[model samples]
Target: MAVDPSDKKALNIAMRQKLFAVATSRDVAAFEELFRYYGPRVRAYMAKLSRDGQFAEELMQETMVAVWNKAAQYSPDKGNVSTWIFTIARNQRIDHWRKANRPDFDPNDPAFVPAEIKPADAAFDMNEDADRLHRAMETLPPEQLELLRLSFFEEASHGTISEKLGLPLGTVKSRIRLAFAKLRTALEDRS
Candidate 1:
């Protein structure tokens, strides 16, 4: 049970011989040796693929069963034992994936919820507020308006707006701040 995993050549030779013993004589002891050596490894591999420990454990069981049933078919000339075993594990995962029963989508899920409907009067007030904001924006000097438009509507940073408009960075920040103040005051007065 204390295999020096680092001594892979020895392990492979042992596995080959044990597998041959299992194949030729149905030696349960030889099969048990192979299982002890490779069981946890195959389970770990299935865990990574399935992301579910119990399901991975199940897949590992299926894979080992396959290894047992197909032991006689193995050929050292074809490939090593580990590759053959892992290949069986991979196929078991794929087979389970193909038949997995995913839960039905929840209709009441928050992501699927429709937005709340607005009352008629509240909708009208929102439109009026938008109009008032638009008029306040129209009152801004073209330069300040352009800076605000580039900064917000275009989602450009103050530094980017400064570069695009060829204005000092400080000036761009100041004008956007001033534009917000002017709009706020104008909209307040209108209301």
Candidate 2:
């Protein structure tokens, strides 16, 4: 039977009343009637959003199940039955897309696995590394140490440092490289 397009709002409100009855009284007939009216529409809505027949079918089933389970949560003051069911359909599609796109994390996969590091241990290690690096920087020649500090602490480019220091670009680059090499060697020896 074709419902007049003009009567759609009234029909939706009537359906919601039936759903409320289903919620309060476990009315199987009311639920069956709601499923009959909404199932195809929900499926079509899911199919349009997903563009996958099998997934849409699955989501349609899920939406109906949610409607059945959560019927009690529906309030007429909030929306009509069509609005509530379509919202459920939209959410089901989102959930399905997330599940499909989410990467499967395997605890046994070494490449993807995360190491369990204690927060205190990590902070202590970071402090120790910073102290070692500072000591290494102190051992560098004054000019080279200044270049390293400007490049790192000041976050200046080599060309900018060269301009600021009024030195040749090549000299600034070589000094920074030499400083890094000395620091690396000092840290490696300590390790």
Candidate 3:
């Protein structure tokens, strides 16, 4: 019986038979028909992914070659001919991108790391100054210290801090300013 034009299941069955012929007997005519039907659609998919017509055509050729070589491996139980062929095309695109994006150097190699210019001791005084600042921050009034923590540590905007603390924006700003002044005087005294 002839398959109705609207019957998708019949169409897939016919296509699967053609693919099976190619797989089992290496039927050149069946393969040629399959290629002609799928090539343009594969090319269109690749072009949409790569955004380059020439590159898409190259990838389509790769996909068809894979189809020819791997035809025997295809299983209709897993998917139909169209789905199998398109999966090959998608894999070809991913392989192409992976090769293109690979770095020339082994980034994890220690030989590739840049040498430090400063001696380790150079930052010791800077660490000491940070410790002094921390001590000064601990000495501030609780309200001023809280505002400074929200402003500097949390990186909250002054308006956000005001809203969060239920304080006016000006009050938040003034508290933070006073905290900074006290911290400066305290650090100076320690020096």
TM agreement with the true structure for every prediction: 0.51, 0.57, 0.53
- Candidate lDDT scores, in order, read 0.89, 0.87, 0.89
Give the candidate number with the greatest TM-score.
2
**Superposing every Cα of model 1 onto the true structure, what RMSD results?**
10.4
Best by lDDT: 1
Total backbone collisions, model 3: 0
Q: Is candidate 2 or candidate 3 better by lDDT?
A: 3
Model 2 lDDT on a 0 to 1 scale: 0.87
Write model 3 residue lDDT over 89-176, tens digit each, in one string. 9999999999999978888688988877676677787888899988998999999988988888899999999899999999998888
The collision pairs in model 3 are none
Q: Please provide, for model 2 over 41-68, each residue's C-alpha lDDT reduced to its tens digit, 9 standing for 90 to 100.
A: 8988878876888888888899999999
Error at 81, model 2, angstroms? 0.9
Clashing pairs in 1: none
Model 3: what TM-score? Answer: 0.53
lDDT per residue, candidate 1, 96-168, as tens digits?
A: 8777766678999988999899999999999999999999999999998998888889999988988888999
* Residue 134 shift from truth in candidate 2, angstroms: 12
Model 3 ranges with Cα > 4 A deviation: 1-6, 106-191
